[model samples]
Target: MNSKIYFDGSIMTAELIGEIDHHSAKNARMEIDALIQQKKPAELRLDFSGISFMDSSGIGLIMGRYRMMLLYGGVLRVVNVPHDLERIMILSGLGALDIFERQGEVYECT
Candidate 1:
């Protein structure tokens, strides 16, 4: 997996590329969590514009981030989600809690 993270003021954008399965989710989780703690960004933009694949572990990662941001009184958003993954999120009932950002085309895990 390849990731590029940038912070604009308090909004951090973590752009993810490649698969987000059990193989990489652990590392991804650590990296993202560390950044979240360090920056404590009021808003986190998870840019999935490049993610090609993801498994159930990816769901856990997302949920964990959501909980963290909730504790911080912040928000986590997913951007440019792949159609397949979007369906998985919807079917998994993840969409009900996450707000899909239509303007930028992403999901907000609030």
Candidate 2:
């Protein structure tokens, strides 16, 4: 897996690439968590624009980050989710999360 992270004031955005299955969850989690801890950003925007696949571990990853941000009095958002993963997230009840449409798109999860 590969990731690019950027911080704009209190908002931190992470653009993740590749599969987000069991094989990559740990490393991905560690990488993002480290940055979150260091920055303590008020908002985390996870950009899945480059992701090709994601399994249950992906849900876990999002849930964990949501909890972390909640604890910090912050919030988390997922963006640019592919169709397949969007189905998975819906089935997994992850649609309750704050998910936006593709990059620069106006649609968003309520």
Best by TM-score: 2
- Which residue pairs does candidate 2 place in steric collision? none
- Candidate 1, which ten residues in sequence have the lowest lDDT sum? 101-110
TM-score of each: 0.88, 0.89
Candidate 2 structure, TM-score to reference: 0.89
lDDT tens readout by residue for model 1, 1-110? 78898989999888898999888988888999999998899998777778888888777877888899999889988667777787667756677775456456545433
Q: Write the per-residue lDDT of candidate 2 for residues 4-103, one digit (tens) a residue.
A: 9999999999999999998898998999999988889999999987899998999899999999999888888888888767777776776666455566
Model 1's C-alpha root-mean-square deviation from the true structure amounts to 2.6
RMSD of 2: 1.9
Stretch of 10 with least lDDT, candidate 2: 101-110
List clashing residue pairs in candidate 1: none
